[model samples]
Target: MMQATQKQDFTTTFSVDRNPREAFEAITNVRGWWSQEVEGVTDQVGGEFDHHYKDVHRCRIRVTELVPGRKVAWLVLDNFFNFIEDQAEWKGTEVVFEISEKDGGAEVRFTHVGLVPQYECYDVCTNAWNGYLGGSLRNLINTGQGQPNPKEGGNAPAHQDAATVLRARRTP
Candidate 1:
């Protein structure tokens, strides 16, 4: 087990005024808040999807788990990064999302299970995530609109359709 003081996987949580079901719906709609460039199936377990941010990053995702209004998770089947030495750093990682009721609203907790501080992408990834979840995802749940990547002709690595991201195991 990991000690409390030890560094943990990337995690962030945000609250929305909407109910749990609304939060769930907004989250499952990947194209609404993440990016319009997303391709493939979302909102179902065992679905496959692909997301790319121009050519800087691309990944194939397999939806491994989902629980309506409660949780969702994804397994990274393949990964590529133009700026990283480890082209497969995200391969096999699991992305997880958890939803719970709070103050009559909903709170979404996101975790990238394998994205630890030691990895090169940690800082950049976490920063982007803060913006996506705290800003875009939150807005989507609240106002029915989100600032997802606008079919970028290649911008910061966003728009992958994994629904929920929870990094899994790291391979050397």
Candidate 2:
């Protein structure tokens, strides 16, 4: 049997109001803006992280490294959400975020490594990441809290899940 392969890598940059350290901490606080659809506990290096979507799907995330305001990386262990069971797919797969000060504001760069573009979930995952990192992240930095989700009776899609809930699905 031929092995299925999927990989995607991309970097997105955004400006933030807080300092590098402050900005970094907020981004690492995954539970804050990831939506109640996902649950996880991550505070330090080598900590365990989990993403839950109600009872439908759960993804395991492990913090592989942390470097203060400079960088943070996590590897996916199991993705019940995507339903691809290759453990190797999770190996070396990391979501890394970098923070730095630029032009009186913080610059944040989000990178997802080891995600094969061929995977069906690649587009969704990348789009979701962009919304959370670029949208909610910027809001939090400037407003001290994320904007409410429009679908959940708020004014806008401040988080990734909220945006997905509002976006039209494409038939494959």
Candidate 3:
């Protein structure tokens, strides 16, 4: 007998003083909170964009669904993570954002479908999302600008090969 696999998407939700429309707009402005190294379009349905985190990670995302002032979803066409055994783990995954009215304000819910805890990059990836969705993205909804990753250089360590990253992860 085969057991069914449990769903383990990573999700984060936050409330903002803004309205649903404002929250929806902020979510579509991916570069404002996701990464400044993004390329191509992001605010329209059927649009495609590429997000890069230096040489560490890169993903091609296509907007698959959009509902004004309500929801948005992106399909991951391709993905590459220099630090993971399965570089394309995020491929075919869906990144979704749901907006609704709550407490006379807006409530935003972000989910990364197919990002199960069983994946090797789950912890690191989810932690990063916590910062992006829960912190940076949330800030963007409240303010005009977001605290995105440094554009050129910052305290981030230089990129390392996959083997090196694996070794570092295993180290005490």
Best-matching candidate per lDDT: 3
Winner on lDDT (1 vs 3): 3
Model 2 residue 96 lDDT score: 77
lDDT of 2 by residue, 1-172 (tens): 1122343366678988788888877777675556544445676777887676543246788887787888777887766543333435444567778778888878988777776576555665677677777777677766667542323333335334532443334323
- Pick by lDDT: 2 or 3, better one: 3
Sorted by TM-score (best first), the order is 3, 1, 2
The residue-by-residue lDDT of candidate 1 on 16-97, one tens digit each, is 9999899989988888888788899888999999887765568898888888888888998998865567766788888888
Q: What ranking emerges by lDDT with the best candidate at the front?
A: 3, 1, 2
> Taking the tens digit of each residue's C-alpha lDDT, what string does model 3 give over 139-161?
99988677666575754322213
- In angstroms, the error of model 3 at 136 is 0.4
lDDT of 1: 0.79
Residue ranges of candidate 3 with Cα displaced over 4 Å: 1-5, 154-167, 170-172
Tell me the deviation in Å of residue 110 in model 3: 1.1
- Candidates 1 and 2: which is better by TM-score? 1
Best by TM-score: 3
Q: How close to the true structure is residue 61 of candidate 3, measured as C-alpha lDDT? A: 95
Question: What is the clash count for each candidate, in the order shown?
Answer: 10, 6, 0
